[model samples]
Target chain A: AQSVAQPEDQVNVAEGNPLTVKCTYSVSGNPYLFWYVQYPNRGLQFLLKYITGDNLVKGSYGFEAEFNKSQTSFHLKKPSALVSDSALYFCAVRAYDSNYQLIWGAGTKLIIKP
Target chain B: NAGVTQTPKFRILKIGQSMTLQCTQDMNHNYMYWYRQDPGMGLKLIYYSVGAGITDKGEVPNGYNVSRSTTEDFPLRLELAAPSQTSVYFCASSDRGSNQPQHFGDGTRLSIL
Candidate 1:
C-alpha cells in the first residue's frame, strides 16, 4: 500500500532560524511526491512537487524540498522561518501507476515564533 | 480567472436536513474532486470525476453523493445531515494529465447540528 507519513505533528521554530519539516513515503514504485501549505480558514496551496527531475525542488514563497529516493523521504525546508510562514503543511504521494489517487499524510502544524 | 469557486462559504444544518455543496471551475479541467477536512486533520477524498457525466467514489464516499453533469460543475450532495459530517469542504480541479497541480476553492465551512 502507498502511504505518506509526517512524523511530527507540530514543529516550533524561532523567526529567522532554519526550519525543516520531515516526510517519508512507502510506495511500490517510483512516487510522485508533493507538498502543500494551508493557512487559517483557507484552502491548501501548492508548494512544490518532485516528479522526475532534480532531487532538490524549489517552490513558492522561497520554500524547497529535497527528494531522497534511497531513504524514501521528501522533506520541506526553508532557509529562514518567518512568522507568516506558520501554517499547516501536508505531504502527499502517488505511485506512478495509481489512477490519480493521492495518499496524503496527516499534516504538520508549523509554528514560527517571532 | 476564477480558478475554482465553491458556494455557501459557511452553512449550518439541522439533523436529517439535506443540502448540496456547489463547485465550479472555469479552467475546463478534466479532473474534479471533493474533499472534507476535519478540525485538525488532512483532507479525505469523498468523490472525483474524470470528465462530464462520469463520477466515482474516493477514499471516503459514504454518506455522500456527487454528480458531474458538465465539464465545469461538480456538486456534492448529502442526503441526511449528521453531526459527524460537520467539516470544511474543499473542491479542486486539475487539467488532464499527471503531475499537474490542482487548483482549489476557498472552501465551504459546514456545521451539522
Candidate 2:
C-alpha cells in the first residue's frame, strides 16, 4: 500500500530560524511527491513537486523541499522562517496503481514565533 | 484565470436535508476531485472524475454522489446531511495527471446539524 506520513503533528520555530516539516512515504515504485500549504480558512496552495528531477526542489514563497530517495522522505524546508510562514503543511505521493489518486499525509502544523 | 471555484463558501444544514456543492474550473482540466477535510484529519476523497460524464467513487463515498456533466463542472451531492458529514469541502483539478500539481478552490465550509 502506498502511504504518506507526516510524523510531527506540530513544529515550532522562531522567526528567522530554519524550519523543517518532515514527510516520509512508502510506495511500490519511484514516487511523485508534492507539498502544499494551507492558511487559515483557505484552500491549499501548491508549494512544489518532485516528478523526476534534482533532489532539492524549490517552490513558492521561498519554500523548498528535499526529496531523499534513499530515506523515502520529502521534507519541506526554509532557510529563514517568517511569522507569516505559520500554516498547515501537507505531503502527498501519487498512487502507483491508481489513475489520479494521491495518498496524503495527515498534515503538520508549522508555528513560527516572532 | 479563475483556476477553480466552489460555491456557497459556508453553509449550515439540518439533518435529512440535501444540498449540492458546486465546483467549476476554467483550466479545462481533465481530472477533478472532491475531498472532505475534517478537523485534525487529512483529506478523504469522496469522488473524482477523469472527464465529462466519467465519475467514480473515492475513499469515502457512502453518503455522497457526484456528477461531471461537462469538462469544467463537477458537483458533489449530499443526499441526506449528517453530523458526521460536517467538514471543509475542497474541490481540486489537475490538467494532466497525478504527477501534475493540483489547483484548488477556496473551499466550502459546511456544517450539518
Candidate 3:
C-alpha cells in the first residue's frame, strides 16, 4: 500500500523566510510524489511532483521539493515565504506499478507570519 | 476552458435520504476520481474510474457508489445520508499517463442532518 505521512500539523514561518513542510511515504516499487496547496474555500492546486531522476523538482508558485529515497521523504520547500503562501499543504503518493490512486497525507497548515 | 465542474455547490440532506453528486470534465481525461475532504483532514478517495464504464472502489467507498457512463461525466451516489458522510466532495480528472496531475473541481459541500 502506498501512503504518505505529514508529521507536523502546522508550520509557522516568518514572511520572506524560508519555509519547509515535511512529508514521508511508504510504497512499493518507485514512488511518484506530489505536492498540492489548498487556499480557503478553494480547490486544491498542484504544486509539484517527483517521479524519477532529478532529486530536486521545481513547481508552481516558486515552490520546490526534494525527493530523498533513503529517507522515504519528499519535503516541500520555498526559498522565500509570503503571507499569501499561508494555506493547507498536502503530500500525496502513487505507486508506479499499482492502480492509479493518490494516497494523501494528513496535511500541514502553513502560516506565513509577518 | 472549464477543467472540471461539480453541481450543487451546497446540499443538505436528511438522514436515510439518497442523492447523486454530479461531476463533469472537459479535458477529455481518461481518469476521473471522487474524494471527500473532512475538516482539518486530508482528502480521502471514494472511488475512481479509469475510463467510461470502468469504475473501481477506493480507500473509502463505503456508503457511496459511483458510475462513469461517459468520458466527461461521473456521478457519485450516496444511498443513505449520514452525519459521518457530511463533508466537501471533490471531483477530479487526469490524463491516463503517469505523472499527469489531476485537475479538481471547486467541490460540493454536502451536509447531512
Candidate 4:
C-alpha cells in the first residue's frame, strides 16, 4: 500500500514571501505523486504531478513541487505567496504496480497573511 | 466545458435514510471516481470506474454503492445514512491513461443527522 504524509497541519506565511508545504510518501514501487488544492466549499483542483520527469514540477497558480527520491519527499513551493493562495493543500501518491488507486494525505491548511 | 457536475449541492439526511449523489462529466473521459472529504482527512476514494458498466471499490467503500451506467454518469448511493457518512463528496473524471490529471466537480455537501 502507498501512503502520503503532510507533516504540517497549518502553515502561515506573509504575502509576497516564499512559502513551502512539506509532503512525503512511502510506496513499494515507483511513485506517482500529485498535489491538489481546495478552496472553501469547493472541490479539489489539480496542482501538479510527478511521474517520471525533472526533479521539479510546476503547476497552476505559480506553484511548484520538488520530488526528491533520496528523501522520499515532494514538497510544494511557491516563490512568492498571495492571499488568494490560501487554501487546503493535499498530497497524494499511487504505487506504479498498484491498480492506480491513490492514497491521499490528511491535508495541510495554508494561510497567506497580508 | 463544465468539466464535471454534481447534483444537490447540499443535502441533509436522517439516520437510516438513503440517498444518491449524482455525478456527470462532459469530458468523455474513461476514468471516473467518487471521493469523500472530511474536515481534516482530505479526500478518500469511495469508488471508481474505468469505463461504462465497470466499477471497483476504492480505499473506503463501506456503506456506499456506486454505478456507472454510461460513460458520463457515475452516481453514488448510501444504503443507510449515518453520522460517519457526513462529508463533502466530490466527483472527478480523468482520461484513460495514468498520466492524465483528474478534473473535479465543485462537490456536494451531505450532512447526516
Candidate 5:
C-alpha cells in the first residue's frame, strides 16, 4: 500500500525566510507525489506534483518541491515565506500503475511569523 | 465557471436521522469523489465513481452511501447519523484518468447531535 508520512506536525518560520516542510513516502511502484495546501474553512489547493521528470518541481505561490528517489522523500520549499502562507499542508502519494487513489499524510501546520 | 459546487454548507442532524449532501461539477469530469475531514486529521475517502454508473467504496465507506447517476452530480447519503460521522465533507472531481489534478468544492460541515 502506498503511504505518505509527514514527520512534523507544525513548522514555524519567520517571514522572508526560506521554509521547508518534510515529506516521505512508501510505495511499491514508481510514485506520483503531490503537495496541497488548505486554508481555514476552505478546501485544499493543489501546489505541485512530481510524476517523472526534473527532480525540482515548481508549483503555485512560489513553492517548489524536490523529489529525491534515494531518500524516498519529496519536501516542499519556498524561498520567502509570507503571513498568508500559514496553512495546513498535506503530502500525498499514489502508485503509478494503480488507479491513483491517493494516500495522504496526517498534515503539517505551517505558521509564518512576522 | 463554478468548478465544483457543494450544497448545504452547514447542517445539524439528530441521531438516527438521514441526510444527503449534494455535489455537482460543471467541468464534465468522469471521476468524482467524496471525502470527510475530521479534526486534526487528513481527509478520508468515503466513496468514488469512475463514471456515471460506476461507484466504489473507499477507505471509510461505512455509514455512508453514494450514487452517481449523471456525469455532473454525485450525492452522498448518510443513514442513521451518528456523532462519529460529524465532520467536514468535501466533493472533488477530476478527469477520466489518474494523472489529472482533482478540483475540490468548498465543503459541507455536518454535525450530529
Candidate 6:
C-alpha cells in the first residue's frame, strides 16, 4: 500500500515571510503528487500537481512544491505569506497500485499571522 | 459552470438513521469520487465511479454505499449512521485520464448524534 505523511500538525508564519509545509510519501511506482488548500468549512481547492516534470512545480496563489525523489518528499512552498494564506493544507499521492484514488496525508494547518 | 455540486450542505442524523448525500457534476467527467474529511485526518476516499453504472470501494468504504446511475450524479448512502461517520463529505470529478485533476464541491457537513 501507498501512503502520505505531513509531519507538522501546525505551522505558524508571519506575514511577508516565506512559508513551507512539508509532505512525504511512500509508493511502489512513480508517485503522482498533488497539493490542496481548504478554508474554514470549505471544500478543497487544488493548488498544483507533480506528475513527471520539473521537480519544482509552481501552483496557484504564488505557491509551489518541490518533488524530491531521493527524499521521497513533495513539500509545498510560498515566496511570501499573507494572513489570508492561513488554512488547512493537504498533500495527496496517487500510487501505481491505485491510479484513481488518492492517498492523503493527515494535513497541516497553516496559520499566517499579520 | 458549477464544476461539482453537493446538496444538503449540512445535515444532522441520529444514530441508526439513514440518509443519502447527493452529488452532481456538470463537467461530464468520466470519474467521480466521494471522500470524507475529519480533524487531523486528511480526506479519505469512500467510493469512486469510473463511469455511469460502475462503482468501486475506496480507502474507507465502511458503513457507506454509492451509486452512479447517471454520468452526472453519484450519491452516497449511509445506512445506520454512527458518530464515527459524522464528518465533512466531499464530492469530486475528473476527466477520464489519470493526468487530469479532480474538481471538488463545496462539501457537505454531516453530524451524527
DockQ for candidate 6: 0.79
User: Tens-digit lDDT track for model 4 on B1-113?
Assistant: 88999999999999999999999999999999999988878788999999999999998999999999999999999999999999999999999877678899999999999
Off by over 4 Å in 6: none
Clashing pairs in 2: none
Best-first order by DockQ: 4, 2, 6, 3, 1, 5
> Model 5 scores what on Cα lDDT?
0.93
Name the 10 consecutive residues with the lowest summed lDDT in model 4 chain B. B94-103
- Please list all clashing residue pairs in model 3, or write none if there are none: none
lDDT of each: 0.93, 0.93, 0.94, 0.93, 0.93, 0.93
Candidate 1 residue runs with Cα over 4 Å from true position: none
Which tens-of-lDDT digit does each residue in B3-104 have in candidate 3? 999998999999999999999999999999999999767999999999999999998999999998899999999998999999999999999877889899
Weakest 10 consecutive residues of candidate 2 chain A by summed lDDT: A94-103
TM-score of 4: 0.97
2 against 6, candidate with superior DockQ: 2
Q: Candidate 1 - CAPRI tier?
A: medium
Taking the tens digit of each residue's C-alpha lDDT, what string does model 2 give over A2-110? Answer: 7899999999999999999999999987888999999999999999999887999999999999999999999999999999999999999995567788889999999
Tens-digit lDDT string for candidate 6 (B57-111) = 9889999999998999999999999999989999999998776788999999999
How many backbone clashes can be found in candidate 5? 0
In angstroms, what RMSD does candidate 6 have relative to the true structure?
1.0
Query: In candidate 4, which residue ranges exceed 4 Å CA deviation?
Result: none
Q: What are the runs in model 2 whose C-alpha is more than 4 Å off?
A: none
With candidate 3 superimposed using the best TM-score fit, by how many Å does residue A1's alpha carbon deviate from the native? 4.7
Question: Which tens-of-lDDT digit does each residue in A4-111 have in candidate 6?
Answer: 999999999999999999999999889899999998988889999999979999999999999999999999999999999999999998886674888889999999
Instruction: Give the Å error, residue B12, model 3.
Output: 1.0
